[model samples]
Target: MMLLPDAEQLLANLTERMRSGVATDTAIVGIHTGGAWLAERLHHDLKLPLPLGTLDISFYRDDFDKIGLHAQVRPSDISFEVEGSHIILVDDVLYTGRTIRAALNELFDYGRPSSIRLAALIDRGGRELPIAPQYVGATLALPSDKMLALEKSSTGKLSLRLYDKNPMGHEQ
Candidate 1:
């Protein structure tokens, strides 16, 4: 069994790294689900001025035709201006980079930002694309068959879970 690292500690470390690097005008946006959860904590801890934003890249996903719609697709919420503002796109795991690509495509629809940086809680090295994270909590290597996920408790505690991917499940 793979021993998982502490998610709270990882987030704490990631927050510190982001604190020094981000500009005061930087806006934070989290990918839906795990990324959104992480972004919520980071946004509060970092005390950003802009309202927090989230992306639901379901429609923008390259595999939308292949996979069809996700059961729980939520609308993206970006209340602040996108143009000329620095953006830090947050995600729970950085793997194939497809999700980030989809997110970028969606974000541009709002308007071009001055810059967009990536922040991931875990960087699992299996990249089909050339994308990478500027701020990361941890770097891990696992078999392709294994999956890692971020979990949040009802009381808002965070944890990591590693498990075998279903044989029929599509890769993220």
Candidate 2:
């Protein structure tokens, strides 16, 4: 397996991208877990006007029937009005594109945003959908059998891991 980039380096790259394009009116929303964690940091670093928003897209997933429900499904939270607001949707990893698709559906449920720009820490290309990120911290290519995941320690340190996707599930 290839060495994963340091989380700090990836965050620095993401910070630079956001600093350049994001405007005052743009709101930040992160997809659950890793994405939310990344978004929280970005919101604080960028000093965005609105509070950080988090999304739990378990219910909105296209493969909900096949995968069933995830155990830790949290409610999607967006305190600010979404109508006509420019959105910066953040995620830790951009893989199959389904998560982003679900995130979009859940976001629209709250309200329609003027625009949504995708931001991701890593882009490992295995897209099943036509989704692409506007801002990417790092990009890597791996085989279909291997899965990349973000790990956040209790103390808030971030790391990455690789897993083998098996027929039953994942082998970590």
Candidate 3:
């Protein structure tokens, strides 16, 4: 596993993209796990006025029946109004796009947004849905057996890595 770009670079790119769009009253929302990790770092960097929102797509996932329930489920947290708010959704990686689909469903539960843009640390391509990330730190192309993960150090640093995972669901 190798460390890719650090959080500072990622935040720079994200802020640039958000600036180009000129979104007003922007809010940041991050999916649980890896996305949440990246979001925390971004919130500090961007200094968004609204509180950071978190979405756990576990229950909203389409593969819930096949993947079963995750042992650790973190609830979605969005206290402020979402309607007409410019929401910048953050995620660690953008791949099959299923997670974003689930996240959108969970997001509407809070309220509809004026615009929903996505930001990701890595875009691995191979999207199953029509989703796309407006801001991406890097792009990677890996084999089907390979997977990506983002780790956050206690000192508030972000690291990206590639790993191997069994797509068959036969290996844990």
The local lDDT score (0 to 100) that residue 49 gets in candidate 1 is 85
lDDT of each residue in 34-93, candidate 2, tens digit only: 899999999999989887899988888787676677778898889999999899999998
Question: What TM value does model 3 have?
Answer: 0.87
lDDT of 1 by residue, 49-141 (tens): 899999999989887777688878999999899988899999998999999999999999999898999999999999999898999999999
lDDT of 3 by residue, 66-133 (tens): 77877788878897798878888888878898888888998887788888989987788988889988
The total number of steric clashes, by the backbone 3 Å criterion, in model 2 comes to 0
TM-score-better candidate, 2 vs 3: 2
lDDT of each: 0.91, 0.87, 0.77
State the lDDT at 51 in candidate 3: 84
Where does model 1 exceed 4 Å of error? 168-170
lDDT at position 28, candidate 3: 83
Candidate 2: list runs displaced more than 4 Å.
169-172
Better of 2 and 3 by lDDT: 2
Ten-residue stretch with the least lDDT total in model 3? 163-172
RMSD of each: 1.0, 1.9, 2.8
Off by over 4 Å in 3: 1-8, 19-24, 167-172
